[model samples]
Target: MSDRHIQFQTLSDLYDDVLPADEREAVRRHLQSCEACALEYRRLGDTLKLCREYAGLSLPLDGLNDRTMSKIRSARTRRLVLRSLPAMAASVLVIVGVGLFSTGTVFVRDRATVAGSRLSYSDSERVIDIIRKHNATISQVTGEYVEGTVPVSSFNDLKKSMGFRRVAYMMVDESMPDENVHWGDAIEEVGHDTGQPVRDWAPLTGTGASRQYVRFRVFR
Candidate 1:
């Protein structure tokens, strides 16, 4: 019989015992000659043995099932939110485009609000109102923002201080503002400055926005 490399998927199916009899026999014969496939099969066997050991372990912990289920639910929810993000952004863009085309008015008034300009104060206040309004929809999936202040340093420090895995930070651009005046741009700057990645952003404080300090949250 000619020797051929058995595919990982074929091996997986063989382990799961879902292969037809002829294919199973063929794979069995291949495994007998292929030292590399034999080693991989042994590794899979060891992993299964470990899983069995883990399943049979009795740990002293209260509410273990509840905690495990809770984590599972949280993980599933996060996955759902992550999966939905692109659609949500597209929907928002479509809504804004329609509003702009129909009403002859900008959907987000703060879209043009620039940093360090005289109009920033009142304009940002209005913009923040718009942000809060949009935040209502975002909170449906990400949960409410845990509002708090953190000292400006690095992105890792900010995340560590807030106790969040994924987050987006926002603050009013007081001065020394980069060309990005929009909320998304400003938040991106924060991400760059702090060396952390962000997904969503919203206003933390209105009018009297600070430059040194920032308020942020972990929502999704």
Candidate 2:
């Protein structure tokens, strides 16, 4: 092959200057005639010269190698913790399950008995009667005391029977006497004079029957 062809073909290999002496001489001869090969040789020479200049200059160290190694270790530890978390949680669940199985007798027994037992037939009847009486009392008390649309004469009789010191209808916001009234309803009924919604509000039955409010606030 011609010197030009040989040099072009082998320029990459010869760039390292590792070629045999004969091959290097051939490449030099080729570069003298071949413009393209000559240009390649000059470019390689420039790159080598630049590399040599930079080689003498020290690369800066900002402790990056140690920091990078620390980050890698941290990442590895995190991965290990993440991988083990499910197993740790599962072990805790198993321990809890064993404890529950050992100590849960009373809880399980109460649950089972409550689920299985029915009240005796006579007890059921007594319960029904008590509930009915309680409901009736509640209805009567709520009906008698809830404010609105009573005859004036009846109102006076009611006030006397209930032993109120004074009784008078007054325009008051429904929410003033009872916060349970919706704001919209209270605003709508703003101007109407009515008795306080339940001045003597009291539970009429249940364990609450002996409640102090019944004696002091209501009956008295």
Candidate 3:
């Protein structure tokens, strides 16, 4: 038997289906002529076939692709819902919180709670001064009021003066005399613009005010 006929490298390429058809035919001819190479090639082919058979036995082949794909899709759906849960809960909370407090008054103080406290008559005069010095126009109706587009300095002063850690701009419709109009819509608009929660409320008084205004009031 000849010590060399075809190299194992060529045989490997042929087995892997990487060899061109002509080269593959050439290797096949060499394998047919050489007994040693032919035996080795047959052994390699048998080993690969056995490995494939073993793999088929080890893995579940009944609806395997469908089941695996279904599991993957389910996992992705679960992850998507989990990601959206907080935003959903927060939206629900905002709706519920607004409904609960919409009819009642809210404090402009630093700490905002359902049962409002820390807002009293003693801070009313100081709060008004803070609003006035900031060049924020107030209603002559004895309630707190300010207009939008004021200077940032005045806004900060009002917040500090009111002892509130945060402040929100609420849009009021003067046309709605008895009740707040577009309150939720206003809250959404202001929240989107300022990225802050609307935590303050003031009465819309009948002072012959023709335009919408931002009002401030201390909740008792």
Candidate 4:
């Protein structure tokens, strides 16, 4: 594949055993050939191992049952919301984000890409409302495409509240600031992610990593 179809969060889910059997197998096959993804998969495992060890040393934790049930409830809620949504609701959203930047342009550490049919005008308004509700900065709006920065703290709520499917991670050329490129411009060049839609974004937090570009092309 010209563009990597694996997402950071998707790999994390695989490591955590959260993906369905077929999906998990697909990622495994991809990892076998993609050296970078394979390396990342290993590193992610190491990091999670360390985190688990660290938490065991210091942090209190909820029981496994509580955690498991919480995920079950959350998944059920998303399913219910999606089923109840009208035709006017966004049927599919594909989020693809680029590299993490620290200073110039926008200080973004996360990216979201949506690839599907163009959104209807009414649906576009609702998408914009969610972006605004999360206090994301809107820099560009062209047809169904919206480009801007979303806060790290609120990204999950925004993603979950709306329901979503994520694509692979992408990094733009060094000459271009990630915040400046729209998904449309980039997708044509690097190609779109092939991975099936799945869950949440990669965890985003760090010094100078305050907001992520929630640039999308699914709304007006």
lDDT of 1 by residue, 110-158 (tens): 4434122222333323322333333321211111232233334343444
**Model 2 weakest 10-residue run by lDDT:** 135-144
All models, RMSD in angstroms:
20.7, 30.4, 19.1, 26.4
Query: Highest lDDT, which number?
Result: 4
Compared with the true structure, model 1 gives a TM-score of 0.28
> What TM-score does candidate 3 reach?
0.33
lDDT of 4 at 11: 91
Per-model lDDT: 0.51, 0.41, 0.50, 0.52
Say which prediction, candidate 2 or candidate 4, comes out ahead on TM-score: 2
Query: What's the lDDT for residue 3 in model 1?
Result: 63
TM-scores vs. true structure, each candidate? 0.28, 0.34, 0.33, 0.30
Residue-wise C-alpha lDDT for candidate 4, range 46-96, written one tens digit per residue: 998998898778555669789899999999888645533531132222221
Assess the local accuracy of residue 51 in candidate 1 as a C-alpha lDDT between 0 and 100. 95
Which prediction has more favorable lDDT, 1 or 2?
1
Q: Evaluate candidate 4 by giving its C-alpha RMSD to the native, one decimal.
A: 26.4
Clashing pairs in 2: none
TM-score of 2: 0.34
Model 1 residue 125 distance off true place after TM-score fit, in angstroms: 65
Residue pairs clashing, model 1: 155-194
Window of ten residues with lowest summed lDDT in model 3: 140-149
**lDDT score at residue 31, model 3, on the 0-100 scale:** 84
